[model samples]
Target: MNTLSKKNDLIDEFDIIAKFFTPLAKDAPGTFGLLEDAAILPTIDSHQEWVVTVESIVCNVHFLPNDPFELIARKALRVTLSDLAAMGAKPYGYTLTIALNRDLSDSCYLLEKVSHGLTIDQAEFGIHLIGGDSVSTDGPITLAITAFGITNKAKALRRSAAMPGQDLWISGTIGDGALGLQVAKGILSKQYSDLAGRYRLPQPRISLGCRLSEIAAAAIDVSDGLILDASHIANQSKCRLVIDGGALPISESVSRIIADHSEMFELILTGGDDYELLFTAEPEAIQKIKQAGYELDIPITRIGRVDSGEGVDVLDHNGIKLNLLIEPGWTHF
Candidate 1:
């Protein structure tokens, strides 16, 4: 793979597909030989540790072809990194899997886009792209990435550790990505181009999530929409989640977009693609998060709490349950 140019043809096309990775193996299980640039598995002798996560971005499903290619690369890498951040992982490196359509002759263009995306993010996080795979197929373009980070495994935040009475919190604003895509499709207009930017290039709250691990009981990135991702944490922790409808932290810009459509709250609530972090913490930690200095342009809002039940409820300001046709957001049929 060429690191700097779009002219380098895709090479090292491995036909012998590697064996399917087990969940543990896929998680970059246990430490191994740690070199200066590559990962050196920590031992009883070494204090450093590692955590791994893998994610994929498919063209038709996760993004659109007309979407700026550079932004596409940014979104794909950010999503994978979001997963790493949720685990309180300090990024070390990443591996990519690219499946290009056979009809596309210039694999170089895709590589260049991918590299550009990685470079921008690496500058901020100090992570690197150490290795990857490139293959051709009849399917839509797909980019899969596995990112590794060093963290204390015992201290890593988990999705199943939320306790009842813990407070629920989200980083940054919600619903921009969902609304942004609508603008991109011309379903909406440039009147809300800022919203469209949210969809095309979700700024993952990486540092915030990493810091929250020090206090959060459980955490997840809001990729599958807040409703679905929150449900995952609720169900896993066996607690009921009560989210206050009005407390959702949507941008004023998104509110303007919704002003045109009236059904704005619904889209923001269920719309997927918002790569923010959703986490549960002890009530006492709420003030600390506010003081942590990670607030983005939009503020973090506390929407609900973990309760002693099995599902999530959306309540209005009066504490009445709100009616929603879409119970959970963005489920694949």
Candidate 2:
């Protein structure tokens, strides 16, 4: 199981580790590469607790078959990293499990490109590859990542802590991920290629999350679209969230598309894959949150408020709650 022979060269999985993955484990103090079965945790503060999360991506399910391996690898890692961000944690390290298709001609080369991708992110985020597994699959190529982080023991953010007087805030713009999917599918014009880039790479709000642990009353990463993710917080907190449709922060790219095709507004509100942060904070914390966003240069928008109730409502500029057309979020099933 450790080796897969190719026509020109007989590089096995171990060689692949030596060439590509060994260096990634350097940052993790006790992980001496694939030589060991386990990895050690990142350096930690005495008062911090470990926060971990896992996510999987599959060909044609999470991404297109023709996607570059590097982008695929990066996306798979970011989704899991976003989970850590939602809890107000600092990324420590990550483990990866890749299932390669032996019959697919590109699988071997894909491993190299994916490793390069991981290398890029590891340097950018200061995380190391602690440990992982590699396997052969007869089906489509699949990869999973288990990300780890550290946060103040008792201060991790929660989705159930929101209160009636909290203001709903969102980090960064939305809808580009869905629009980007359209571009990838050829349903959209090439002029929207910028949007497609967004679908491929999501900017997880790690810096913002670290700053909001004590400030925000509740928080969640927006992976399953705005409406659905918002509903998660509202439902758990036993409160109603009134979102102003007009106040939703959208890029100029999406604003142009929705201007001519107003129907896209529903898509903007309900599309999945936008990895921005959705959170709520007390009214008194407004200035502090704004200041933090200003300092971090991450756009933080006040889009709504939490009220005493049980559901989420999206309102028009004129105060009418618009019934959106599609389901609010994405599901694996």
Q: How do all models score by TM-score?
A: 0.85, 0.96
Local distance difference test scores for all models: 0.74, 0.87
Q: What tens digits encode model 2's per-residue C-alpha lDDT throughout 53-150?
A: 99999999889988888999999989889998899998988888888776766655777898899999888888988888777767778998999889
Writing each residue's lDDT as its tens digit, candidate 1 over 172-194 gives 88888888888888888788898
**Residue 297 alpha-carbon offset, candidate 2, angstroms:** 0.8
Best by lDDT: 2
Question: Backbone clashes per model, in order?
Answer: 5, 0
Question: What global local distance difference test value does model 1 have?
Answer: 0.74
Kindly provide the TM-score of model 2 when superposed on the true structure, using C-alpha atoms.
0.96
